[model samples]
Target: MVIEFDAELWLWEARRDDSWTFVSLPVEESEEIREMAGGQRHGFGSVRVRVTVGSSTWTTSIFPDSTRNCYVLPIKRAVRRAEDLEAGDVASMTVELVDI
Candidate 1:
């Protein structure tokens, strides 16, 4: 399944000293994915996915965020740099389920 959306890139406040950037999937879409993934969920209820932002594409996992009741896709520094993204910036993203 392929999902596309635009969301703000935010830093994980829990890790203030670390640079962990992420974009959250929409709540509705997250629910769909949760139902679809079913028993396929891996550690931390993560789902393998191939993500694309601007011209950068990479494989990663989206983890379930209980606070937000959704899945958050981590944006690696390399991809962020390649796509010219920063925390608080809105990014257009494409995510395709890899393992489910």
Candidate 2:
């Protein structure tokens, strides 16, 4: 399934030194993805996906976040640079479930 949404980029608190950035999937879409991805979860309950932000596209995994009740997609440095994204910025994204 393909999902599209706008989300704010945020730095992962635990990885502040590493500058790990991410965007949370919408609650409704997260629920839908959970249902659709049942029995397909990998390590850390992550679902593989192909993601697009601006002109950058790459394959990654979205991990379930119990604290937020959603999945979080990591934004790699390369993609961030290619798209000119930074923390606190609002990004329009497209996520497509893959290898499931």
Candidate 3:
């Protein structure tokens, strides 16, 4: 799945405790990825993907946890890269993290 963000809004506010706080950090619209892998019951699958922005490349993953019955993937590095990339996007490699 590839999530494209037009822009990210970062809002800050001052707290009553004499500290500054982040009010909002909005990310671009999210995209969904769906795939089925062969396994018994309790298994996991992970794929290493590469996200490219301009000339930079970041490694990422898609993890499916069978025990939890859910698939989750974090784009933390991609989000951070958004800071430097506005006209950039991501590309990924397909691989299995685990098979049981």
Candidate 4:
């Protein structure tokens, strides 16, 4: 989900393995200009982080679920539960926009 107010778009973050991917947010250097020009400026932003035994990553997402705003990792072999990670562990994530 995306929060848009007077052209300003506020998107939450989503987490993947090594890097993060968002729906509409620009990650590539080439798209930076287009993204900045398309929307109004935002004051602050946040990225979601997931931590595992081996490593940690963070990403931004477009989800608006207040309870689950971030794309959490599934409980599996590579991705574990949130409780399993330590305080310092980190993950990568990104944020973008989603059209309803």
Predicted model with the maximum TM-score = 1
Please give each candidate's TM-score: 0.96, 0.95, 0.28, 0.19
Cα lDDT of model 2 by residue, 22-57, tens digit:
999999999999999889899999999999999888
TM-score winner between candidates 1 and 2: 1
Across 1-100, the per-residue lDDT of candidate 3 in tens digits comes to 3443222222223334212211110122111233323333232445454544345445655455343343444435344454442213333322233331
- Worst 10-residue lDDT window, candidate 1: 13-22
CA lDDT, every model vs. true structure: 0.93, 0.93, 0.34, 0.29
**Model 4: how large is the Cα RMSD against the reference?**
13.5
Better of 2 and 3 by TM-score: 2
How many collisions between residues are there in candidate 4?
Answer: 23
lDDT of 4 by residue, 9-95 (tens): 122245435233222222342144234434432223322323222353333222222353322222232333432432234433332
Q: Which regions of candidate 1 are displaced past 4 Å? A: none
**Counting only residues 3 or more apart in sequence or on different chains, how many pairs clash (N, Cα, C under 3 Å) in candidate 1?**
0
- Quote the lDDT for 8 in model 3: 26
